[model samples]
Target: MALVACLAVALPAHAVNQDDLLPAEKAFAAQVSRSGDKLQLTLDVAPGYYLYRDRIAISTTPADLAGKPVLPAAQEKADPYFGKQFIYHGKQSIVIPLAAGAPADFQLNVRLQGCAEAGVCYPPYTHKLKVSAAGGKTESKLDNWLGGAATAGKSPAGNSELAAKGWLTTLGTFLLAGLGMAFTACMYPLLPIVSSLIAGQGATLTRGRGFLLSLLYVQGLALTYTAVGVVAGLTGSLLTVWLQQPAVVLTASALMVVFALSMFDLFTIQLPNALQSRLAESSNQLSGGKALTVFLMGAMSALIVGPCVAPPLALALGYIGSTGDALLGGAALYAMALGLGLPLILIGTFGGHVLPRAGNWMKVVKSGFGVVMLGLAIWMATPFLPASLVMLLWAALLIGAAVFLGAFDTLSTASKPGARLGKALGLLLFLLGGAQLVGLLSGADNPRYPLKLIAASSAEGAASHPFQPISSIAELDAKLAEAKSAGKPLLLDFYADWCVACKEMESEVFPQPLVAAKMGQFVLLRADVTANSDAHQALLKRFGLFGPPGIILFGADGKEAQRVVGFTPAAAFASQLGQVAH
Candidate 1:
């Protein structure tokens, strides 16, 4: 009896509960309905469960009765089991195209696999439905419990399915993209503003108070962003275009200049005495109004500070404008803002403890922030500034920063360790500044690199492959006709100045000798969507492309051979070209 009791105590807690695991039917319920010669399969997924978008398969009994199933856009998730994949939670819908003169009845088979949030994955499940058609009306043999039947000549499932697919995908993409944008040059300036707000909480600052202030600030940003996106969607105008106007750019640059001056202690902008007294009183009483200042600042930052355009932002705006669905658009924008604020929140919470409280070092940190603000101001004015002038401004900034870092100062034996570190950084900056000055003199337009020497060396040997720019569907069709007449394959590249991936391809991938050599075989054409005009949008729509950095290849027979989306490395792209050539 003692041994039995000991064994019982030592044994694992309890046998896995089979009943707790969700059955295939309970986890995912499928419904088949038909509308206007198209069959729609809608899946009502249970909460805490998801189905892989790519794992879904649909076929017909007669084989030729239906074409392949067209899956709706699905939310992207970084799954532990499957790396990066698209999945659908809540509900999803897929449309299958039917062939002409279809039989009155056919068997539709669907095979799918899914998993519960509890980490239990179910095996592939297949469901067969007898689909009957008569007088443009259709019904499934399965019971209506799974939404299998639809009212004749009417679709019970309206645009909700389409909205679901778009919203889910948009939310996922914007959230991830925003996180990446948080670390970019456009968003970096806001970090100092957040840090300063937390630092202003004084010596008694606590983590809880810091978090509250940060949350309020982020909420304000998110709300403003959502509002702007919705308004843009309703108006059918791209806010980024207006924001990037020369006048607006100059005004924003001037505002940043003022902020930078304030940080440098050149002057201070303070509220009136009465307003200060009220704020002090509110802070003393621990009123919510104490955080309102930061909130307003966050809103201003969202609207005026960073107006940079990106592919995700453009895609979202375009979708919202086309669909006029403010709810989903707002949700996507809100998620993006949350992602953008994540880094700021982390910095605000932990920086209070890590950063030096009050010292000479604090002044240095403020001055450093001032320099960054100045750089940001210059960057905002780039559109208005001449290319040469921009390079000169960059050179001046780098050289001035180098001088501040003790590049010109002689370090004595008694110099602090910081002085040594500063000198090293200064030397590096000085070299970079020198390189920029040289590039500026040589009229090299690339601000990121001093490429004049390299360009001159490679000019003779470099392949001279030029791309004919096309902005509209008409132009693209004409170009395709010309290519076909010439008996040459064609490569269409979608590019945008605001797209980082496009720039990466231009600078890193396209410049490769192997890639350039292979490109000589095709007629290269480019559609620059930087303007995002009606024609540009039409071109993108014609190609079924969401945004720039998309490439399409057409064979000599005038048929689209392959399409490439997003960024591809040089080696991979070269291999793809080789295969296409063969």
Candidate 2:
């Protein structure tokens, strides 16, 4: 009876262990198919397993049989073994470019690694595939499998269909993004520019002339945006970053201040008398000269006045970089610019009829614009100032504006509705300004909210896992080694004072309790690239990154697990952390 009980327990334990083990081939199945000059590698991963995107390597037996593969963007994951990484689950397909005059048959080698959901990791597995290519003149089996031929002189019907769909999607996304950006603070200054242009045309301006001038102005803006976007996309350098430098910001702010003073009638900005005479003579005959000037102003507005980076611009640039399709990218940018200029067009065409003409009301409107310009100037200079100083400046501006609006003035019962409204707005501003001043006095950095709302413990927790500063690649490598030795993950953040997205991340994402807790499990490091030193440039180049607002996570094994290129929301970021830390 004792022997029977022992055998019963032993047999069940052995069976359970056997069922837990899965064959490598069953876990990850890879296949190769050729279509014209392109080779498609497909992997069907089992439900419980996922393959690493960066860990997958391909090589031909003849070595020169094929060029490097063009990989699609993979889904981002935070891996337990690797910090942050790109991975593929279920069905994954990768396209490889074949060389000309390649053999009809070649031995293709695929090496890959993956992990099971149950915390089981497999060693790197190698699969040898016998790949047969179809003739250059004929479509291969992959033609049906891949559903397209990417080679030259082939049926581009599939390619065209795909391109058309992609273009429409990109165009729609950019259009919406452009419309949203039109109302942003960076675009406010351009409103006065458009209003001034239209209002300056005098009472003799006709609707037909107004429409023509507006169209011309918008065309100039769109063309400049398209051209700059194409160049920036091709070069993979965003001009917004360079324009955000402290020196550049200060110069731009000073120029805006001067413009604001001019708006307040402190002084007039005029061309030399001889130049004005020549311009007047040119405009008298060929209206094209005036249009040309308007066009130049539009171009300058795009390049200098409102150089804010939006999601649509980043999306278009990313697509251009990946596909090297400048034509499509340029068209997308043009569409977006037209959308952004749509309001300007409307204002230029109809503003003359709507705005009060050559009266005290006009002066009041101009003064309001001057106040707006001053606000923009302060906004531009905020990055260079301490957070506390920025908050105080904002408070001062609001309080001063309230005083100008007669917030403290007593209103009679017989006062006009407009006067009452003005006093009411002024009071609201005064209250908000008072709140901000109190927050600043209480050591709050954020100008948007008061400090007393946050508990002391939460405030302490917010600063607990602050990022360790790193400046050089050597320092990064050393940190990675330390993290590996300690069996912990590493999170490297690329930051810059001028990077708007970076500031957003710091303010909105990193301070979240979930993000902070997840960060505590990793060796937190930050590389401030605001200086753009050679070391900073090298660090960016090493990761193939163009600018800041990039986050890279490395696993306990010292391998990069995930990479996030731009600003990610807190919820999505927390999801990423869940994958690796949990």
Candidate 3:
């Protein structure tokens, strides 16, 4: 009884107090701005709670003096947090930028969320802030300071406004730029020289409607890019006004982590190629038929280039939203698109005559890209997670992607069905081997259990049921006590809803008949840490657990037998349980 009391509920609320929760009396001032326009508003956050990621939702409800406005892209930036751990703090401020021509007295509504450490999370919060623009020495001084960092007045003029000779030259320059960027990203910088080596055939873009149409299509790309830039400029001003210096570092690092994973395909979910092909073909067919089609093409291009838009684009959007300069926001996005797509346009026009066709070596280049991508994915997953878990995920994705790409290549070739099928399987082996190189980085399953499922199975010389969710620490202690009084072994599980591995165990290992049959020999107790249960909180403190999905075994004497921090297969868990039970 004494042992149980010390390990179980000894933790009190005052043990490791977080930040103090302020009373409702405290208030803070908020600012709203769009481009050169600015508004000062008051914001009052509830005591004991803090604003977190994606929690702030900005709206232009009261209508700025200029009119109801849409915040631009490129101006928004993510707010930062101090700790790597997933704890929420209690204070935050959001900056709003004003558009260049926004009116003097603009109004907007703000909605946010608040959280505290007492397991008492608050409901969503809302506020209506009224801001009046400043037009004096202060505005002038601020403009002078911001002129160097802002992107307003930076975009090139529209084609309609350029002289004939200048327009043609500009078009040529942009086309070449788009083509060059495309080629660079393709990673086949030397493709032109090897055009003749692929099946002894040289492909060329002939001078005709197809060529002319391609150029026209690119104009749509340019316009869309400009539109995105305007959006960026508008939001950039808003962020510039509202962004707090304290949260910047934390926000940047968290976003960087997410971006890095997305780039390396660690947790990415891409659409099927068939969907992509149909969309591209439909857009091409609709060229010049409708304005909407052109807009769709621009959207499609944005999606295609999304992977390459990373840190810079994210930062730009954050800045724009935080600020509120629609014009400047548009400029930044246009610049980015121009930088990314300029080479594609250039290659389509002048270089089509001298360029080489696609080749078999393109496959090699693709494979190399895959290797680099996989390596980065592994690196990104290494920071806060276990090496073996990262390797397993990496290995699975590599194997799956290799199989997919191999089959795609074989099917794309104009070969016999039988030959294609055979080629796919063979090429799949190559991709698999290439992908397995990541295994050199990490992933060795525990030898004793061999299942990586976190626990042992009866067949593996252990007697334990597969993983199951336990409801509370009190329930777990009761089971242990009862088991000891009856001279029986006990198995205890501590799991949470947010822990992905726990779900995996419940679905994969627990329902197995073999593990279920062996369950009758021991007293089983499940502690579910999913909700903010007081008992679960006590259990968390008892085990000094930073996170969830914990497993513990107790012998007949009611002492802690053993514990595992993460997922262990049934066989491994069973072995540990069996040892302690005997």
Candidate 4:
């Protein structure tokens, strides 16, 4: 019994599943395909396998192609043995720039290195191909990064998936994606965020002045996406990954709280009179034109809030990783950033004409934004706070706002239209807040659907049948094997308490009866990557994901059939499951 117990305990601590490890070639495969002047490097990487970004090298015989081969962005993985490394997964395309006056058939050599996420690595190997209109002669050479003969030349920096599509087309594509983000985020959901930021100016903002400040603000966002992105890409790390850290998140939240208090007029945010005058003179600033201040705020906010993951973002990341060209990558990302700011330009430049006359009304606006700032601060902190604490905070904010709006004030026929509207709005807020408070008492963790948990008996508002937990590659493999044996499809959800999107899926998507019924066709597994330990990082990197809130589906055949990143609403996820389950 002692021996058995000891073995059992030790097995989990150092578990390695050989069954999950694929043959090196099956794990990662590479080939070269040509399309007119555009020669392409196509890579088909199997699920649970990845190729190293630095490990993929290409050099043509006689001379380089038009330029370097372009591959997609890679996720940074910190290996116990190899430390920090960049890797890629899934079907990826690399644009091989075709040079002028190049022969139709030429010799092209490619080198690749890959590893199994199940605690194994394959030494680097090289392959040589003869380029032709029909097909090329293929030859293999076993080599490592240290082998100088076959492995030579660096992969050029360019966007992946969209590579060789022409620079103008690529930029245009990202610009359109940016416009989509603007309408979805900047135009609506983030209007208040931007409004509150500008309201802190305290003085009347003429349309021109508003345009200038807003333009500066958008430039700040551009600068961050360029500088921060370049650094993170070159280093094989992600800026969002760092910003999500507990210390950084808490600090940013605290700063927002201070900014909120400043807007409340409890304290001013200006420097000492003498110093302010001196600095103003030196900088040639107008009395109320705090251009530098707003610019810095814009930069800071971009860093704290972070951009959503999009295909263009992934391509830009790939560009940064594959090519070390900061200038071109910066330009491409800056274009996208401008696209993100496009809608804001209209709001700032034209929307200011409708502002209330600049006096007491301005003060009211500032105070209102103060409340918004406080809410924003709480939103930032929610990921790190306990579920109970987060619910309490939201309830407090909502109830407080409701009371200030005069929910309890009795209204009469003589009450003004504005007064009646205020009371009605206040009443709505009060009811919502009351429900949220009650939901908190009923053991609800989701603020979005607080009362839904009251119907749940065991866990309340959260996922009733929480995902079967898996922490490491070995455990994931074991679960996959178990599901395969039972002839069941599998759904592995990458989740973290810090991920608001994941919570949305858990509360809003998974709880739906239709979605739940569809999910029943598969074995449900959840990887709580909240701690982000080395093992957790390994599990995430296995599938080439940057962070949590990703879903991977495996058919009964045990091959990956579908992948959904970010939030997927119930109806959509249900439809997806129906297609895969059959």
Candidate 5:
């Protein structure tokens, strides 16, 4: 009997009776899981069945994915077809690296080639997995090949626009990235408190002390928001879309305008006199810890005057690679968190001192910040306003700035070098502001190219990349199936009017002649999530996307090939299309 069994197993791989052979899915069972920076794949082989280790290959959709599988030791076996090869018997688990800047979500294309020790060798087979940091979904090709099931499985979803290489590098990069955002927001509500922290009540704090405190404050700001935002994304919190509502946008912008008004010394906001007296009495009741009391006041003031100062990156940090670690996600938001803190430092230290002391010049500085806040408020409202109206606003702001800079001042004292410099800048701005007014009258709506008719390229119409718009999940599903059947690459864009980055892609990227030509290869579908209705919410949920400005690329086979989150420049977007969908 032993001899007979040995003979049965020793037969050539291709010599088995077809009727006795088990199906491939039964012969090799697979299970997938993820940990930290690695994806763990487990496969159970049936008795008398074996898999070729060298033939086992795993790759992600983007094709240039980092990391490789760390396969365990395999048995050396002589094969009639391929000579001696390393193979696995019984069951084996393999690990694939996934966390080298992997997107919060992606897909993995696995190639599992194996055969039975019985009479036949099965050819190499392909399997596709939809993966996110949270976990992966299995849609085995073996099932479709054997059973002819439809490939209509749901795709997976999270995350930040993309993850960082590692924890340390991510944190460091975010911290430095804060510098750029600070200038972009130009929000300086924290300046007063931060400067006060450094300058103290009556004395200047040491530079080292100021920095440490500022960092602490930023840590406090980043930790809560990023952790909450990531969890919120994973939980499908309404915060993402809810925050984008017109009422909310208007409210946030209004609050900012109030802060700006205060900075400009236009008006002072105070509690009713009756309530103010009671608050003073309560404050007087608590005598000790004057320092603590002062700190409390500063904290309250920061929250009230700058509620919007929290890092916008928090929303972008949504569902970071299913890290399940809020602190890790917070590290990414640290960039924007630091951005919020940076202005405080710069405004305080600009006068050559480590921090700003209360001085007459503070009026000028406050007014400057007020101007920035107004500009930001206007930017927020741009999507809701007409292009012509937006241009008029910009023109007005510029002309107002020119006037404020003493462009038309007649005082002879304007001969001072500083005054002369201001006048020069003011004159330049006045001219540019005049140009904006001219362009607005000339029927040019693009603020960047205010004088487009002068060029007469008529590029605007050519650049408008038309898209077939889908509103709900049902519509999207139908469109996707149609695209798949048409044998073309599919490009799905998540867009909303409120999304500044989405508009950037619309104006700057999609219109590029080369980009447009490349886009012709795709069946373009845009999900206008502008309404944020129940169906719209469901559509976003289907793809695990948090907000607008996301692009999903699918191959002709109907499997997702790549995901592009946030703004992608035309050159890079064109290059990405070069490979097309793989």
Candidate 6:
């Protein structure tokens, strides 16, 4: 089997004889290979464990033989197991491509950790795998059987091949992890606490410490959420393997209904206040170390978040199960957890002291949490809920949450601190509202083939570059100028590192040899807006975009021809290209 590999740590990679020795053997490996003409690397994953994707640090050095490994086009594959990213399981692998003139021998130093089913996590391990290649070959085999060869086909890989690469490359996106961290850190609910920490707390949290803690907390939550997403992603992945698994889809649909209903508390089983208070007292009495307590928290929190996590979770699990990158699926969970917990932890650690001297704010926070819960409900119901009806219900739920929480009454009675805090929170909410509005406006206004004409030119003997992603109007003009002069059709792909749909296109549609061949016909140009380079930003501004993965075509005359936004299948894309190129 041609197992592409990347460099891992260099600890004693011998087979484990668990019965002997103080310093146990640490197993590690990396995968490196070529896709078409590009060299790439996929980090090998140990079974029943995973390595942190974010923790992976590329060396600034280049290989002597190939020069450097080009990073793959990163994209996001839908993961039902987790809402956000891919999770990996079993022997996860990343394809590392080598550039021309890379060294024959080189090392990749990696730091990673692994965990077990029983919740027994192993210590962090390190290793380096030696990589050597004689030239680009179709059949390349790399092997270093540490835990013996993985029981072939027993455990599914977390993500599909495309998902593996897409998830990594898409890191060029506005990092939801980062955005979530900022939002949670500065949420209105936490503002009072934050101000108190800054003013009165003996040991205040510095922005650096807070940011780092936010990162760790978010990472932890993301890991946890990724575990959930892995399950969901694997389910979505199976859609391909089994044609959307109707039974599974129906089950997910039913569960989503329940999630929505529960979030709105439509089927409340009210308990007496005395009983509720006793339960709360008991919960508080239990030490944090108690597994049962944690499990209970997870279960209760999940119930409230069912509407929020399930839709994404189910999709992620299906995706992961199908694609086979459970580690990324796992990582997705960590990312989600990070999103959910970072703010809370920061508030508790740094601003816990400053929370209003009165418990009144608790009610407000609870109400805010309730609103989020309802939002989750609507989101969960969306898969089964008719889009129109879903919107109506979502609006109703929002109104109901506000009214039921007596937000107006609180607003009326709010004192200076309370009013100021509310205003700040409202500002935060306004920002979120603006973001959603922008998404709505752009989504509704986007038209297919908005660019009426496209053109291109190319050099007589320039190495045929595959289709390039274009993010700016200027780049389009430049490529058009070149194509016009050279008399070649221009192929432009507008992409962002963060788009989930873009990822789907890459993982499922772009890699087919036939698709690759057709794509190579034109003078390829890529406009990547993931990092928001000045040029890409200009294009986004011109196009009125709040998000990514817009594909456009150009004719020999160097004018925009047709554009397709979001993920397009290989056949569809090819057909479109055929029309434009001709």
The residue-level lDDT of candidate 2 at 539 comes to 90
> In every candidate, how many clashes are there?
0, 7, 100, 4, 4, 149
Put down candidate 1 lDDT per residue, 320-385, tens digits, no spaces. 443334676677678888888887777677763553344656567557657866776776566567
Which stretches of model 1 miss by more than 4 angstroms?
A: 1-245, 271-357, 449-453, 456-460, 464-508, 518-567, 579-582
* Cα-lDDT of candidate 6: 0.44
Candidate 4 local lDDT, 439-554, one digit each (tens): 98988776766887665443332344457999999999999899999999999998875444565566567777778778888888998887766788788668866555678999
Off by over 4 Å in 5: 1-158, 161-237, 250-255, 272-357, 411-414, 457-582
Candidate 3 deviates by what RMSD? 19.0
* Higher-ranked by lDDT: 1 or 6: 1
Q: Which stretches in model 4 have alpha-carbon errors above 4 Å?
A: 1-242, 279-356, 457-582
TM-scores for every predicted model: 0.40, 0.38, 0.34, 0.40, 0.40, 0.30
lDDT of 6 at 110: 38
State each model's CA lDDT, in order.
Answer: 0.65, 0.63, 0.44, 0.62, 0.58, 0.44
RMSD of each: 18.4, 17.8, 19.0, 16.3, 20.6, 20.0
Question: Candidate 6, residues 227-285: lDDT per residue as tens digits?
Answer: 66566445543443352334544555555555445434455323456855664565455
Candidate 5 residue-wise lDDT, 240-354, digit = tens: 3343457875676676677667655676654566865664455344332234444444334333333333323322442232233444555555455655556564544443354
Q: Candidate 3, residue 289: CA error in Å?
A: 33
Residues 1-582, model 3: lDDT tens digits: 011111111111221222232221221113344335444332333332333444456666444433333322121111111112111222222345555665566456665443332222223334444544443211111121112221111121211111212434433443343443444333232122112111122243343433343344445555676676576555553454343333553355455556545544456434467876775565445434233453455455655555454433454465344434465445545555655544444454445555456665444443444444444434333443454564555556556555655544535556677557656765674455444443434344321122334333324423344434555666666666777899987777666554444554554455555455455566776776666455666676576543345566677788877776555566755566567765
lDDT of model 1, residue 343 = 72
Prediction 2 TM-score vs. true: 0.38
User: Which regions in candidate 6 have their CA more than 4 angstroms from the true location?
Assistant: 1-254, 264-324, 332-582
Give the best candidate by lDDT: 1
